[model samples]
Target: MTLNYYPDKPNSESDTAIYLFLRIGKETIKIKTGQYINPKHWNTKPDKNGNHVKRSYTGSPEFNVWLDNYKKDIHQLYNKLTQGNVAISVKELREAINSHLKKKEPTAVIGFFEHFLDYIQITSGERSKSTITKYKVLYKHLETFSRDQPYKLSFEAIDMRFFDLFKNYLMQQLKHTDNTLWKDFSILKTFMGWALDRGLHQNLTYKKFKAPQKDIEIIYLTEKELMAFYHAALPLGSKLDKVRDVFCFGCFTGQRYSDIANLKRNDIKGDRWTLRTVKTDKSYFVPLNRFAQAILNKYKDALRPLPVMSNQKTNDYLKELGKLLGIDEPTSLTKRRGNEKLTNTQPKFEFISTHTARRTFITLSLEKGMRPEVVMRISGHSNYSTFKKYIKISEKVAEVEMNNIWQMAEPKQEENQ
Candidate 1:
């Protein structure tokens, strides 16, 4: 077996990563040492004592010591694995070395909630603010469930029994619908998987925990309703007018409330607006239609391209605006809590929210003959499963429109006859 260390980027002036190269028989493996140094400070060749880095440079002594110890650890690990007389490949050897090198610091014994907080802290940089907020919300729900039932929450305690208990608590006590419960359980499973990867516990019971989700009704404005709402007059310079414009901007551009709120004047170029979506962080180039462009021109002299409000305020005002414009078609929504199915019917205007704008854009776009792929591109939807819901809504709208067209055509044929 031969082992050597080399800079990842030998020609680079900036700091570069170092990698350990190992060759045993016909098997060769390269692994990152998780150390970085400038190319000038890194030695490509070993000296008389077979040391790649000399102790002359700053921090070189400590770095060399770590390298020496790392090599020794790898050799000792290989011998230990071979002494069992079991065939071991480079993959197994590499994994053992990685575990040894990247051993997590010993954490104090803590409850599940405390460990969850630590997980949030450590992974905050990797997750979006909204995602972290959702995780925190789930944490609160779990805390409440634990306190109410007096059940000890720990990694080892997460089993089929805990799943059943928590599932019942979410449905019976919290009255969460199937969809909401599914989302919460999904986040819980993600957290469990993360904890498991860190060697927190070997419990795999969460893998069997299932929370089925049901498709709830998606509400959006029809083309005629959207046009009427777009042209609805409000008091000039009023909050409602601003909210209408911002909401319509989202409807026209197929963007979320967060993205629309964060839209900048610099993001617009000609008739197109290119910006990264706040939720997914995916860049989308949305072409501005006549209506969308008009809204932009209306707010040309304003601080922002459009007068954007907080998501909550915008959603509140959208319902009010929808009601004012007489967009009051009745809509019904059905949801499930455990085995009980509950249905609620209300004026469609009452259901209008910031999210409705994007749905309206997608539904109307599909109904008006835009292909699903094109709509998905503008909406930044990579998953067909989620986008399929909008397609189903559009198909229903098309059926209704086709019936109307056929009814009108029958009268025209009779008149011609």
Candidate 2:
């Protein structure tokens, strides 16, 4: 293609020039009579001086209408010059517009994170609702951290360095633990797996960012202490320890929070509470222990409105109540796990989580020399390793029985005094 031009300005000295023109090999077009307009007219604005100074129109609504008309004129001029020959598709127009917009900004990738979020929602149908909520928070943090990067770190596109930095942020900045950091990493890894399956960009730093061994210490109150904790908590009313009750209920019946929270009045029949857990989809026929039933009765009004303790409020409040009961410290409780750090200011119990209830059930039952298989069924553990992990060797139980069999070998009491 070639172009010929007629230079025109209102103050021009030449009147012999026509309009600018273009030509292809055998085809040619000319615009000799059309109006000549300023090139900067597409991107103009008025100055404060109120002068009709040269201006350009931005791609705003007002200017967009004008740009389309101008483009039509150009296309017509070209075809009129080339005899209706240069056919362009819609794709070409889109590309041209995109190129124009991109040039207005730096070469950095824009809205990459936005696109990444859309990709995650579209592809990862396997993610839990809790996970999606967490992803939103993670995405917000990533957006702040990646302000200088070309692309926003995405859920699935994050590298091992991203994980490393994120874990550091959670630990050093947020003061979360190894287990807490692991939860974040696990979600990220799951998202990466989703991304990998969908052929998205893979991270190079996953192995390096991974935390080691991912072990957590599960702890709970002893049966004696649990009773004390509950009796102490009895005065708190609806502000009661539903977690403790639910946990104790879980300890006795082996149901998880997912199943426990969804339990309904209809779930009970002939003193047995039956529920199918949402997480594992396992149905449990728990013969409601008297302690568990007492929890249900105490919280009938509070729990009638909702099934599980959905807020962290009850857990926090229960910790306060536990302190009054002397089961406040981790070491003060017999069935409690040894890995927990005890608080001094007793700023309240922090080590107690929902899992403590499950562990307590397994610990107590195993301490009583209950069969592992029976414990597994009650606790709903599908594996022996998991059941064994919670089967704590009760030092008190061993010490209490230390001289019983040996003393029997020596002799028996001849008379009752």
Candidate 3:
């Protein structure tokens, strides 16, 4: 085997990166060394004038030392590959070289994904807690997928065929809907792209693969249901009562649960809540309606409108509150996976989470003749298309709206006719 070092391409700095070309018989494989210096510094022979030109890297002893150490490491890797007269493919050789160079990095796909999760937390200080949680779930799904593999996966294993197998695994084994599958695959693609950017992996099959997604069926409480929940009797000052008030406040104000959970006394201005939103950084002034204002008045002596709890706990309490209020109307849900159709029916209250409050606000507001633009202001939705999706209109509400429009447009019969 012969190892020749040369530049793969010329960079704008006129300095080119050096790579190792391994020639075994007629087969040659090139591997990047991730080192670069000026062309003048890389010459190993005399000039055309027949005089020896001093190496430029010699001027920097620190750089020279690092270069020497890297070269020695490469030599060791080459020896390791050839030991025991074992035949090594170009892929194995490259993997060995990279594993040696990056001492602590995981060579398997699973290990790299774990490393990536840590990297996201450390590097992405701006990511929200909920956003981080989604990535954590994505990692868990990857662990499940790789649990049955005979050998650990590498970047090389993530090709077009792998995507097919993974999609099947998610459908058959995990029983994931198109939406869930889409989310998982999208996260995987994002991580793979991030890896590519950092030179950790070179697989680009994910680029050709498109994640499956269908329009989500938005479910929200109607005006009657909202009123019923508002009037539901509960012992005064109980935990459920307080949580119900907070949830009702969200339904009226169209604010996110995170924003509502973090609502401070200072964020209130006169009859309006004014501040920059936590996630979007956009300024908003949401005028409080009677229902929302009443909830605030109940906790007037406190520093904030409601006692704080973790989002998960709040959601758990909300589910229990839904059950207590008899909001157990059966809600039918359906989704598609490839050629198969899947369906389920459950109590609507079982699906009541913090997000439902925002949806309720949007849907009920639209049902009560509020303009879409006005509703968007309170909901902090900058995109009209996305704002439209959040409003889940019932067939009754749609019929009522059409009748109202038709009645207004009706022509009066001429009295003289």
Please report, in order, the local distance difference test score of every candidate based on alpha carbons: 0.84, 0.56, 0.74
In model 1, where is the ten-residue run with the lowest total lDDT? Answer: 408-417
TM-score of 3: 0.65
Q: Distance (Å) between predicted and true CA of 9, model 1?
A: 67
Measured on C-alpha atoms, candidate 1 has an lDDT of: 0.84
lDDT of 2 by residue, 73-133 (tens): 5555445444656565444533543454355445654344665587568745655455567
- Find the number of clashing residue pairs for candidate 2: 10
Off by over 4 Å in 3: 1-111, 150-156, 197-203, 275-283, 383-385, 391-396, 400-417
Candidates by TM-score, descending order: 1, 3, 2
Q: Encode model 1's per-residue lDDT on 1-417: one tens digit a residue.
A: 788898998998766798888889888889777777767766688777666665544445557888888778777777888897878877888898778767843455676898899988887877778889989999999898775564557788898878998999988888899999999999999999999998998999999989978876898887888888788878878999999888888899888888887889999999999988766777869899999999999989988898887888988988888888888888898898878989989999889998998999998899889999999999889999989998888788888888988886446445554
Best by lDDT: 1
Better of 2 and 3 by lDDT: 3
What clash pairs does model 2 have?
28-81, 29-81, 42-56, 42-57, 43-56, 43-57, 44-55, 44-56, 44-57, 160-205
On TM-score, the stronger of 2 and 3 is 3
Q: TM-score of each candidate? A: 0.70, 0.55, 0.65
Please report how far candidate 1 places residue 92 from its true position, in Å. Answer: 54
